[model samples]
Target chain A: MAELARLQADFAAAILGPDADVGGLGGRVEGDGIPAPLRLNVYRNNFRQGLGTALAEIFPVVQAFVGPAFLKAALRHFVVAYPPSEPMLYGYGAGFADFLDHFPPAAQVPYVADVARVEWAMHELQNAVEEGVLTTSALPEAGRVRLSGNVRLVVSRYPVASLWMAGTGQLPPEAVNPDAGGQTAAIVLSDMEIRLLPLEGGIKTLAETLWRDEEPDAAQLVHLPALAGRGMLTDGETQA
Target chain B: MPILKRTEASAGTEIGVGLKSQHYQDVVATSPALSFFEVHAENYMMKGGAHRRWLDAVSDRYALSLHGVGMSLGSVEGLDTAHVRRFRSLVDAYDPWLISEHLAWSRTGGTYLNDLLPLPLTTETFEILVANVSTLQDAIGRQVLVENPSAYLSFVDSHIPEVDFLAGLAERTGCGLLLDVNNVFVSASNMGWDARAYLDAVPASAVGEIHLAGHALKEVNGLPLRIDDHGSAVSEEVWDLFRHLIRRVGPRPTLVEWDTDIPALPILLAEAEKAAVILAGETGRRKAAHG
Candidate 1:
């Protein structure tokens, strides 16, 4: 039992990284039919399979992009790069995007990491409880700043949504003409549905007004040019 | 006709759900009409997190059960002590109402597959199983129910029947049977065997609980295969099987297990309610649990 524990810890550590001492389980443990390294090889395959399958579940975009065989190899690297901890398995591979950034083989695909971030966001969104959208009718006289985990985030990015679309099969591979592109405004929605709205020429300022938990009174000009010029409120009709 | 007369012994009071993170908050908050909640001990073999928090919260509310999927209780290589220690620590920490693992082997020579694989019912395998279960019971210091697994393939070398294997294991180690009814349907359909006869062979008193889950049917190499996906609702046939089972077993704590494509809480709760109804009507209600 003691020998097995030492071996298991060693095996786990070896899988973690090179700079680990798994009670000599890092090198070899000889046996018949399947020798020690051979056994470890099986563990390596199974470990990769388990973690890879998990990653596939979370990031179908990456899986679809790489296809099954390549995805398996890529996931083998991903697993070693990030072996999951227990209990918190749902959010286990949280650091995967960063890992994908530094990963040697995947370094060529700069977009892969960004794509992973979007998928991770989707994974989170699926589990996140829905909240009411920000509205101006119930405006607070005093504007306060808050950054709860449930805070609404509206991101205006250049081409990240396009990349996400292409990766997730929402926009088919051909529809995503790699040469043609455009930036989009997207809310990091936390719920059953997710949408990507391409930012119009004038949405930036409007988005900024309600970006925080504050009222739109001070930043009211961001929504209307006349209000900004007058330094006063605009009529409800002007919102349209 | 009733397969087995409803008895208080068969329909024990303790019923539980396999704890998943999705329902952690609800599990802690609104006290559901449940006798207990079971978590895969392997999932909580960590230091701390929501796993500890929610388990601690819900444990205070209801009886807890530590159901394990990784312990290769039927392994010929013998019990893994590190696994035992983790399970022991979990049991010591939670002090659950029930402790159990599968009557199957999933590892050999240190490469754990992490899936419960079935063992052929040979005399040799039986000896290994007996030794393994006894060792696990001795180490855990409690009688653990050995669960029947949903098998994909049947072995040619088997001598004893499924019920015989379970009964023998229980007899040898004084363990109980966590009879997963869905597994019986799956194995029977996959192997083209009679599920009823298999169910009839086992005495109701040996069973400790029942599991009802959905399975996916697939065609692998021109053969129909029923994979226990647990990703959907319980099938009509499986429901009928559960009815037959509870008619015999008489209102045991049956769990509605949906592991994938998990529907809303209302849907799952509704399914459990349906099972509760079946148990009440099928066998004369010894005790009525209000939802």
Candidate 2:
């Protein structure tokens, strides 16, 4: 009904901008030290609170980087652009990193997006299917049948791995300057956890094909991977 | 939806604890002396995966209750029949011992605040709930219990007292009441009303489950505004209210709900055990007094 929408709009307006004419909500406008404005302020606070908590949950690393105040301001911007469309609050906040990329404020911090991407990957990885991966023994005796919710990965950049390591306290406080970096490799969320290693292109292809039920006619790492490949890590010898 | 059929005189069922995922192995191993496990219906609403996997694992061992926080039962708009259908499917799949929702509404039109929002207790609103509950119950093909809310503010236009409103709801829709005692204390204290009187007003016979939790006090302009925050241990006053309530209503299924700032599993178990002690004491007293 028009009345309900008006009430919601008023409530929203009162939340976003208290000076706006927020009218016709069921609760009172005054008399108990509670202005309609203050009531709406509480709602605004809750709105911010919900999103803020959710973002912190999803990107604790990013939150650490930006700190609470910056994150809070970023979230205020996000909520205006991306109010939740569904009741399920857990699965929200997919657009923050991209939003940051275009955001003029974060222009100085260009690599924030890359860092956010890492955090988002970790977030997604947490919720990803935790099926059993290929065992070490299974690696030798296997036809590449595609591993279950599992794969091995290799990143060309050790700095990404070191950055992750530095963030996670796996490595010491050796600040990984991405500019002054040796090429890094990672396992990349393989083994159901983020692992960084030299990019192994062939075995990952075999795994991906197997995972997707595609048995490509190749016993070796046929992808001609740049840094690392999974299939038959022989010493630079091409298969006959 | 309101309950399709409920026996007011029916004996209260066994107590249940909210199922947390971490305790799956411990619960399976220990088989602790719990009456049942209540889970957020939405949590296990997934089709397959760990939520379903463990729920299936534990389903054989315990009675399950489906308590939903998202079904905006008191919304002015008609119930989301899709939600009702999903609930019905879950009910069919899980076959829970009891199903319940809040007296509060969350979604209005299409947007969802996802908080258990307060509703004005009035004749018009009653009509809305009656229709919504009836429709939801019909869709779900089962009965439902409605829990009372923790209200922060009162509406001047609202003529009906919350107790009467809730009791009236149960009467009209054939629903059971999940009497949240801490909510009662908080709402009563915040609004400056008599909680004992409100408890007396709510017919004891209509209640199916009892909920107790801690609250935080917010002094909004020196008026003690008790926020129904289940973050810490049960307050002495809330415990006192609980003792008073169960003594009157007899030993019903009670839960010590600690949602925010959830402590370790053992700490939660200890809190539940504390409630059990009170329940045991009351049970002993009743036997001595009545028998």
Best by TM-score: 2
Please name the candidate that would achieve the greatest lDDT relative to the true structure: 2
**Alpha-carbon RMSD, candidate 2:** 6.3
| Model 2: docking quality category | incorrect
In order, the interface RMSDs are: 10.6, 3.4
The regions of model 2 sitting more than 4 angstroms off are: A1-9, A12-27, A30-33, A103-105, A121-162, A173-175, A179-221, A224-240, B1-13, B21-31, B287-291
What does the lDDT come to for candidate 1? 0.63
- Runs in model 1 deviating more than 4 A are A1-51, A56-73, A76-105, A110-240, B1-15, B285-291
Q: TM per model?
A: 0.61, 0.79
Tens-digit lDDT track for model 2 on A1-240? 444434444454455453324455635443366555544444566666666666766776566556677777887787656666555554567778788878787776555555566666555545444444333343434343443332332232234555656666666645666555433232344433554443334654454454355665655435423212332222222212
Clashing pairs in 1: A10-A22
Residues B1-291 of candidate 2 have per-residue lDDT tens digits of 334443343345355567776677788888888777787776665444445777887788887778888888877767777777778888899887778888887676566665676665678778888888778777777778889988766665568889998899888887778899999988787677798888878887778888877888876555566777587888988888888887787887777777667676777778788888888888779778888
lDDT of 1 by residue, A23-89 (tens): 4553444322323343344344445665677677787776666567765777677667656533234
